[model samples]
Target: MAERHLEIEQKYDAAADFVLPELDGLPGVASAGEPEVHELHASYFDTADLRLAAHGITLRRRRGGTDAGWHLKMPAGTDSKQEMRAPLGRPLVVPARLAGLVAAYTRGAELRPVATLETRRTVVRLLAADGAELAEVADDLVTGCGPDAEPERWREIEVELKGGTPELLKAAGKRLRKVGAKKGKSSSKLGRLLGEAVVPAQAAAARAAARSRIAAATSNGKGPGITTGEVVLAYLAEQVEAIATYDPKARLEEEDAVHKMRVAVRRTRSALRSYRPVLDAERTVPLGPELRWLAAVLGEVRDLEVLRMRFAEAPAFVVEDLEKREKAAYRRMNASLREPRYFKLLDELDRLILDPPLAGAADRKARKELPLLVTRAWDRMAKDYASIKSADDPDVARHETRKAAKRARYAAELAVPVLGVAAKRVVKDAKRIQEVLGGYQDGVIAMEHLGTAAKRTKVPAEAFALGVLYGKEQCEALAARDHLSTTWSQTLGPSF
Candidate 1:
């Protein structure tokens, strides 16, 4: 089993000759507990190229402390990390589960012991008036060993919060400074031993600069060696990042996180479909179904959230029914997030961004290639719009039209940064079509939910209210249908 916590702490470099200062008189410290000492031994692991360390991530197996275990630390904030812990296993071996969790960064790279630190730590606990422990301070003497380096030694002070506020940390820093202790030179023992920052700022800045140039090339429609493939892949890469960025937020049930992740998945899938000329469709086709699988699972929870908020005025019994379904939907969402298939999907996406499969057309200038792609998507939407206008089952046709509109909108969006105002105009019109159709689809879903609620509760007042809501939705759908022709005509002319 494993557990996670936020490790919030500060560190300061201490001279070998410095004496320990009295911390009891600080802000919330009423008295201090007896000083306890421990000899801690930790071995750090990383890829041969130091991939994990370069990203400010650490994997270690440590012993001889109250928190001894296998720990993985990922950068969370300026001075914070999300630490995941697992029980100690056989010596010098990392736990399989812990290794699997970081596969996103390590990929298939080997995790070998890179460095070892042996620390003789003296710890003091600061207390509050109520005897509640606020924080713990550790003064340490360390010996570091690397692959082929001679043993090195250092001394430092670490102030880690147990139940303390930021104010307590600030107060402690003041006292430590007065006694000759200064801020720690490095964030981690491993970082200090390696003599490098956890994240290499210069390397990160250079990568960011390169990405900016690629973005500029597409946006300005000018850059030597810029190709149609570069623009599409850059947009796709951004969406891939969005999916990963929102993954944890959605798992933690943050507001609208799931919706944003789902949108990223849809946008990526649409980009792949719309830019088939620039990319080899055969290789990219498999990705579409995987993206759709994720989106459908996310939609189950998102749709419920929308309904619960939309019908907040519904009768108590109806609201209760909705709540039950919402809980089940959330369970489904959480289960899907934990599945191995989802992780595989993420890995595949990362691989796609790293090395995309491109065809001959990809090397051509985006200025000439992208507009033609946009026109194809628009023409598909036009056909779907005409079909909806003439179909007997207008509801079914409207759904298809909605999907087509979305594709056209995404296509225009990809072009807007390059094609300028003309593409922006298409984006606006395409969006209106999508929203109008979205409302109709929502109404369809709402009626089904209302019918289910009416059956479950069998309450006459609730049933009557459901009928009224259904009628309103019917009217809205009809109104949207009436506006479709004008909306389509506004921008789908030969010029666009």
Candidate 2:
């Protein structure tokens, strides 16, 4: 089984001759345990070009100490990381389970052994008043070797909290600083071994361009001026980062992971479509289908998740059947994650961001064109809402209107930084319309699920319960329809 936990720790540079400092006086640390020495060896893996390192992700296999395994570490915060561990295999290769999680970062790139660190670790546990261990501090003599570089040696101290607060770390650092310890030059052994050479060319170019733009903006006495390409790319980058951020949550089956992931896909597709004038259609238009494909697969499970929650009060048998369907849907969703097609889509997304196909329109300042784009989205949604006649069944029309509202909402969101309050107000109102239409569409979907369940069940009580659930869904749908016109008007009452 795979296990996960957060690795919260601090590191300080240590001279080769530096001696251990007293830990008993540190805040919350009552005493220190006898130091135990162990020899540890870790091999870091990344793309030949170091893609994972560039993104601040580390994958390694270690054989030493009590926690030996294949470890995947992702950045969590300033001084913490989330680590996923799998047991080491006999032959020593990256575990498939862990590899799947980094597919977004690696983009299925070939992960080869990049560097190896061998450490002689002296571990001292800091104890609390009641004799509970609060933290472990490791003083290490390290040797690092890579395929191309000669072996290098260094010394460092790592203060890792077991159950201690950050205050304890701060206190410990003060003691270390008194004895000539400084903050570590790099976050990890691998980082120091690779140095600054691991940065990808595209990443370097982006940073340089951003610096130049900021300098120019500073001289003009205004904040950085964003171009059409920058605005769309910023939105696109956000969604891309959202996908990366949510990957672990989705893999761990956290609440709303599937929904949030689907929304990222939808938002990216929406940005690509709405900003076609700025981005090259020939390059981005084809990605729409791939995004929809992913969202649809995810929806199979996400939709079932909502239905199960909505019908929680239904008969036990109906709820049991919903559970069965949800389990099956989730199985399919998990299986889809392992497919080559999904990883290919990730690779495509990476390529899109690294080298976007921008047109001449993308060069225009965002202030000149962003408002026009947002207004277009708002007007399109209004038109869609107006086409829904009162006498019509409205299911199809409501779904279409929801789609428009979603695009308008995301478009307005993209405009907020440049357009300010006017954009924010539109986003607020667009969200309400979207929610109303979403409820209507969900009700329609729930009623269909009830129909299907009724046909499948052999028991009379279950069928009757399904009937009652169907009626409730219909009533909810009617209510949503009743409020649609008023909500739509309210959403459009203000100008963009």
Candidate 3:
């Protein structure tokens, strides 16, 4: 089992001649304990291309430290990381648990020892007036070697918070700066050792060129100053990053993680479908089904999660059954995440971002091209809304309308960067419609689940309770259906 916690710390580079500063008078500190010396060795592992380091993630197995183990540190926020630790089990092979967490980044790439670091350290503990340790300051002299690279040596300082506040961390950094310490060039030892390998050179150059082009176009005062392709690609890149970011959390079954990853998949698929004019359909069209496949996998888990929550107030047996089903769904989801099909989808998304297949309209100014696309999506939604209003059975029509509204909402959101307020208004209207219909759909599903539970249970009281819940949900579903026409009239007053 892996232990997880947040590691909030600051790192600074100092020359060999620099002296360690006294930390006794720092904020929230009454005294500094005597220095303790230790020698530590760590081997950092990543793919041949260093994918993990590029994303600010570090995986290492270390020895000769109080926290000696396999540590996987992932970015949590500025100046902090979520660190998961496992006991030192093997010397060479990466731990299975840690490797699984990083599968999203590795994508089947073989993990190898990319760098090794040996550190001679002196540590002092800063303590509060009551002798509670607030933070530890480590002055390290490091000798690091990367694959096929010469050994390099440097000196740095790290202040890792234990029971200290962020302000105290800032104060410690200030004290270190007064003694000539500067912010470290890289965030981690592996990053400093691997250097440009952490970020592929070709990708870096492309980003730089894109920035230059955008800057030149802005200065020229051209119409909207950006192309539709650029706007669409930016949105696609954001969704891709979100999917990777949430993959590990989803695998761990963390709260809301699966839903977030599913949303990213939906947003990516929606953008591709809605902006087909600006993108090459031959290259992007097939991705829709692939994305939908992944979304359905995640949706199975998410729907069960919602069902579990909805029945929290039901009988214990009902809640337990729902939980067992949810767990089984999660197991299926985890297996799907590790499938080659999912990895291929991720790789295709990356390639699409790096070398976008743009169509003829991609070169058009975004402000002009995007509104037309958004209007088309709005028109599609309006068509569905019309069907809902006239249909004899609105239940089936409402599901289609909800899906259409979602597509329209995603289209408008993508256009917001270029269209601003007008696009925002369309997004608001589409979101409202999506929410209303979505609630109705959830109610319908809940009623069905309740009905099933009522039939399966042997107990009379439990069956009666399930029956009452089913009736309540059916009434709510009908009410939502009744309210839909009025919502459409108010929101769909004038199409974009």
By lDDT, who's the top model here?
3
TM-score, each model?
0.72, 0.91, 0.94
Give the lowest summed-lDDT range of ten residues in model 1.
Answer: 201-210
Better of 1 and 2 by lDDT: 2
Question: lDDT of each structure?
Answer: 0.81, 0.83, 0.87
TM-score (C-alpha) between model 2 and the true structure: 0.91
Candidate 1: misplaced stretches above 4 Å?
Answer: 1-55, 58-73, 76-210, 216-225, 316-324, 338-340, 468-483, 489-496
**What are the per-residue Cα lDDT tens digits for candidate 1 across 1-496?**
3688888889999989989888898778899999999999999999887877876788999999899999998777877887888898876778876776566556567799999999999999999999999999999999999767889899999998889889999999889999999888888888888874345633333334436867777557465456787778767777876786676556556699889999999999999999988888777899899999999999988888898887888887767767888789977876677677777787777667666788888998877787899888988988988897589997888899899999999998887666778888888888999998897788778878777766765667778988888788778867776777777667653244
- Comparing candidate 1 with candidate 2, which one achieves the higher TM-score? 2
- Score candidate 1 by TM-score against the native: 0.72
List the candidates ranked by TM-score, beginning with the highest.
3, 2, 1
* Per-model tally of clashing residue pairs: 1, 0, 0
lDDT of 2 by residue, 307-335 (tens): 88998998887788889988898778878
Model 2 gets an lDDT of 0.83
Model 3, range 327-423, lDDT digits (tens) per residue?
Answer: 9998898788788998999888888888989999899988788889998998999898888658988777888889989999999998776676788
Q: After superposing candidate 3, which stretches have Cα over 4 Å from the reference?
A: 200-223, 389-393, 492-496
Ten-residue region with minimum lDDT total, candidate 3: 200-209
